[model samples]
Target: MHEAVLGIEHPGAYSSATAGTDTTVELWCNDHCDLLHVGGSEAESVVAHVEDAVGVRERIAEGDERLLITDACLKEHGDDPIEATLAEHDCLLVPPLRYAEGRKWCRVLALDAGNLTAFYRDVSAEFPVVVDSKREVASVRADRPLLTLDSALPDLSPRQHEALLTAVEMGYYRIPRDATTAEVAGKLGVERRTFEEHLRRAENKVVAGLAQYL
Candidate 1:
């Protein structure tokens, strides 16, 4: 799976917002870091939606359905307990990690809508503080360029085009945890790493080509 952008120290303690309802939640997991890894099949779509908002909550997918894991939540909780709560909600947890070694921060992946992170107030400072750095959410790279990629060729290039098209076909952006990169790449006769590189390069080219818009 791809890593989200690493923000400040801990992303949990930050105040969060949840759309939809208390049962199915979608919220922003944005933080202070600049680099972000969007690994899910719908990472692109998620990023696109995230761009409309301040953060990306999580994702969900199914076999060939490309189910959209709609509904995210921004909370004031930590990763583990929140994830555990999500599990209680029938959302599978991907992996969990402690980010900075302060024993209070980490990041993990789960079905987007199923994410239930914990939050605590950072009161050690002068005033109240909210944090969500570990969520690995990334703001749209406004610096992305779109000029290099030919509008005609946007649909070309074996590697890049194939990768993007495949993701779309699989509804990676739809959500609900569809097929994984390995799953998609395997069917396409390419390694997941190769596919990812193609996608990364394709994204860079597109960003470069579209830089003027920003």
Candidate 2:
């Protein structure tokens, strides 16, 4: 497998409003539509800017995090050359696009390394795509049996990783629970339920991954 990363500026309302700010926007796409999580001290301001700019009326809030919608139609206007190039080459997106400072960063995992050159060519021709870096993942040899124990490590999102690490250091998992979920959440600047939910999900992934080989 090969991992290709590209960074490009977005002319959309969300990224434009967040540029040079502490606002963070994490984006995932489903059926070619965007699902956005906008969070930070300036989250509300960012949301307002996007809503006003795009004339979107829908909003969904999850604890301290807010979900906002983006105009998928904007991509057709050459805003999302990365996604378009991936579709053309049938490449898989390993990670969702990350937005910061008005730029969209994406990492894709491709089965055929040769696809990257074609994909890059198309994107560069169509949009102002910046090639951040590219590297090949060393494939495991079929003759050597690899241990499954390493799979015990959880596949955590950035937020989940932070929550888990904080809980552990604060002795949240210790006897009698030294740290309350609220306290931990406060320390992380998120809601208590949000912290607990992320922690539970992380624990579940770790347990399931470990138990599979047992």
Candidate 3:
């Protein structure tokens, strides 16, 4: 299978919400509504902007994060141009689509490289697109296990997940430690003690969950 990670310059509520903010939005869409997971320091504002821009059906807050159900699907808002184009070339979009830095990032899969290339060409003709990464997988079964990690790991609270991700992203776990707990806390707009508590709890849960595999 041919896999591609694409960055598309498409304007919509998700894109607009992430513009000029540290927020990132990940969403899974269905025929009825879209389920969005929003995070970062500006998460609340991002959610508000999305609600105003596209209207939300429901919203549930989780610490500094939010889970929102959109009133309509992306197809209903005419934001499925890329999906439609991909279908024309027999490509599949892997969920959940991510929005950050004012753009849409999608993972697409195609059985043939030719079809993948054709899909990219057709979509790029309408929207500015960047091929972030592309590769051919030897075995779909081999990669399928990676996708199941979410289920294998114990669930962390929204804050715990954010704390862990922020720490990793800041290189706090690097060999020499590129960042300190205080620095990570500042980035998340939280106290150092709070961040440490969240991170430690997350680490414990993750370690315990993976003990069997180890």
What would the per-residue lDDT of candidate 1 be over residues 80-134, giving only the tens digit for each residue? Answer: 3444443554433232222221122223333342232322222213223234433
lDDT of each: 0.39, 0.68, 0.82
* Candidate 3 segments exceeding 4 Å error: 142-214
Question: Of the pair 1 and 3, which is ahead by lDDT?
Answer: 3
Each candidate: RMSD to true structure? 17.0, 8.4, 5.6
Best by TM-score: 3
Number of the candidate with higher TM-score, 2 or 3 = 3
Off by over 4 Å in 1: 1-156
For candidate 2, give the lDDT of residue 66.
76
lDDT of 2 by residue, 19-90 (tens): 776456776655445667775546787777766654344568854457876654234335554666788898
Candidate 1 has an lDDT of 0.39
lDDT of 3 by residue, 87-198 (tens): 8999988888888778898888899999999998988898889887888866545555325445468656557788999999999999999999999999999999989988
Q: Relative to the unseen true structure, what is the C-alpha lDDT of residue 89 in candidate 2, on a scale of 0 to 100?
A: 92
- In model 2, the number of clashes is 0
